[model samples]
Target: MKTIAGFITACSIACSALAPQASHADTLTIALDYDPADLYGTLSTNNPMFAMLESLYLDDPRTGQVEPYLALSHEMASPTEVMVTLREGVTFSNGEPMDAEAVVHSVTVFSNPEIVPAYGIYAPMIDSAEVIDDTTVKIVLSEPNPIVDLLLAQIIVVPPDYWEEVGGTEGFGQAPVGTGPFVLTDWVKDDRIVMDTNPDYWGDLPENIDEVVWRTVPEASSRAAGLRTGEYDLAMNLPAIDVDAINAEDGLTVYEGDVARIFSLVLSSLDIHETPVQDRLVRQAINYAIDKQTIIDALYFGKARLLNGQVVLPGQPGYDPEMTDYPFDPEKARELLAEAGYPDGIDVEFKCASNRYAQGLETCEAIAAMLGDVGINASLTLLESGEFIGQYVRRELAPIGLIGLGVPNDPSFGIGVYRSDWRYSYYQNPEMDALIDASRSETDPEARAEIIRQASQLLFDDAVIAYLFGAQSFFGHSDDLEGFATNVAQRFFVHTLSLAE
Candidate 1:
């Protein structure tokens, strides 16, 4: 890929046609690194189509919570039961009624892993659901789980008729339908996704831009170049190489987004759930050998921030300030290795993804050098995201590679990923499991946050992972893009975006 030159904002677009309601054209052409997968019922890649731009649900990113989207209000039936009432008279983009049964079907579909593996985090815990009325749905969790509210934020509720019309899960992916703010027009892989505003959209339309075109600008420089040339209006993961130029551009702005992506170097021992990786001394030494701050500064061009814990963003309620990160210390690393019975060094194979995380391959290479100094012969192997995730959940099959969050979202996400059962490092501890259970069941925010912190401390104590850095979803767009605000956890909600003509 060609290295893109610095940004130069060009006011060349003919906006007259972009505006549907405004005096000028209102189309916003944004760019993504990859195109969204088929927005089928549940199998779509976590595309902005179903999560942000083209969709809406009961999520309030401000509080790290999900409310009701098409649903009017949700009531607590019991400690482990949630009763949701759909907004009355809501219509799908195709003009179908979005009622309670539709919500039930969506929920049921999400509960099945065979439908969407990512949704399994939300589905596995659901015990059952009862269709209380035409507009009301009640979800009963196996336990008192709060993440259920967060899960609803992106699980698009489809019209029951739409699924029946399309056949089933297989058909749903091809002829996708949703009650979101926009309707899919066309999708070309590694190209662009065109979406027209839902004419029958029940909620508020983005005031600045009408239609949204999410493009895939494969290279960081290319993405930045497109933003500068007026070929694109919003760009994700603008190359760190051009941060200042973007900030200084006349019509552009460089805003920070949460990297919600995490990078780690894990050592999965043969036991599958109990490896030499669970050694606190080994894990801490690995962290000592590597310098996280340097990587963030260099790779991110100072546009990114170093993060810790699963909850790194400041806005998230459970961000524990006390959960400090280890500073870089080669000497300390050597000491830990010696203490762990490898004074000279230990041979270990390290694996990472080529393009999974932002600059993941580079990260693995850098980490290997650090480990070399500590007498750990680290062999770096890179894999794509699919094989990396599959082998990780299975354990010992995949190299001790770095993975961000096993589950989607936050602490509730930690339940399945960091829990003892997940075998993150062949680690299993009763205390860890008990704390996870307590946090999941706790209704009070403070109490739950404390338990989450404890769980984090437990994992940290065991050195289950060579904690490297937190995810800061870094992206760039025109400064004038309204409704764009950086939350604590670093998720971008375009529903909050507005553009000036």
Candidate 2:
């Protein structure tokens, strides 16, 4: 593995395409660590893609409240039904009107399990969508979903006629037209994605920034360098170790916020993998082996919040104060390893994405070293973002893997990913599944919170994953930037950002 400075130097050749050029006065060149998998709002949830699309409701970054955007108002007609009224005269980038029919089409596309497979985990409760009138859309669910609004907030509208006319999901990725303030003018994968202000945008555009260019700069040091050298006005996911360096420099600002993401180590609980991770005590040992506090203090500078489980943060609903994390006890880890029949040692392959999270690879390296100290021979395999996610989606990850998981709105959303029925799940417990289902249908907020708390406890007791610290979200920008804010969901609202005179 290369040092951060060395990695940045190695990427210089690739970044030279845009790093050497001078950005326009009105254009904002934002640097991201990875290229988006897709821009169609399917199989992709990157920040840059979110800038090119807006949901029916937008979460206010300051308040964390769900506010209406395209939808003027919504009401629950029944336990399983929601009636929504659309904003009048709103049009997509392709000049198509955004009406009830268009909403139905977008919902249909997202609800289809075959068309967009990712939606099954995000919105499995939505059974059907229908148009009541030109401005009204009705949504029927398979069950009484308590967080339907949060699920619907993930859906970004696309022009129905233009979507089909271009082809389908694949075509829409190449040329996506949305109702967002920014229109995608060019997208060269793994290089850059260019967007211009939509003239027919229904919402207010950034007064100063006319064009937005997102350049893929994988190394964090490179992005920091780009921001410092005036090549980029803003950068996403800066390395925490360089925060003081960035803050100490003149004309630079860092916006720090708490995100709904957990960086944890997942061990395969399936029988398909004949490894020591299959044993319960071995998993427990793995949990006790790593020191999360050290990682948070040294790597994250105590900026990240610690997590007892991967489900929710301290301030979030359903968070259980009684639930506790495994202490960093290497002796206890060795005892558990010996009890699990790995008295001498057991070798485990750990796969992690280098560019997925802040200091991800460095953390993995530290974990591997700690595991070695506890008599477990752990080998670390660093992968690119695309390869890592592809393997993860296919459920072909190694015995041990490190990745970040976020329970954006509800605990059930994260629980659904671990159910045996879900394609992405590798672990399945009947009690866990029942709790998740019961909590989903629970109408009472307090009762639902209790059920979710029990589920979180069960997951923590089961040693489902080596719970790491909660990731702190951050954005790096030059002094000339203003009004830049990011939501708890880690979506960046580029339209609200403007140049400060």
Q: Please report the candidate that would top TM-score against the real structure.
A: 2
- Candidate that would win on lDDT: 2
After superposing candidate 2 on the true structure, give the runs of residues whose Cα lies further than 4 Å from its correct spot.
Answer: 1-25, 117-120
CA lDDT, every prediction? 0.63, 0.78
The Cα RMSD of model 1 versus the native structure comes to 7.8
Q: Model 2 lDDT vs. the true structure?
A: 0.78
Give the clash count for model 1. 25
Cα RMSD (angstroms) for every candidate in the order listed: 7.8, 6.4
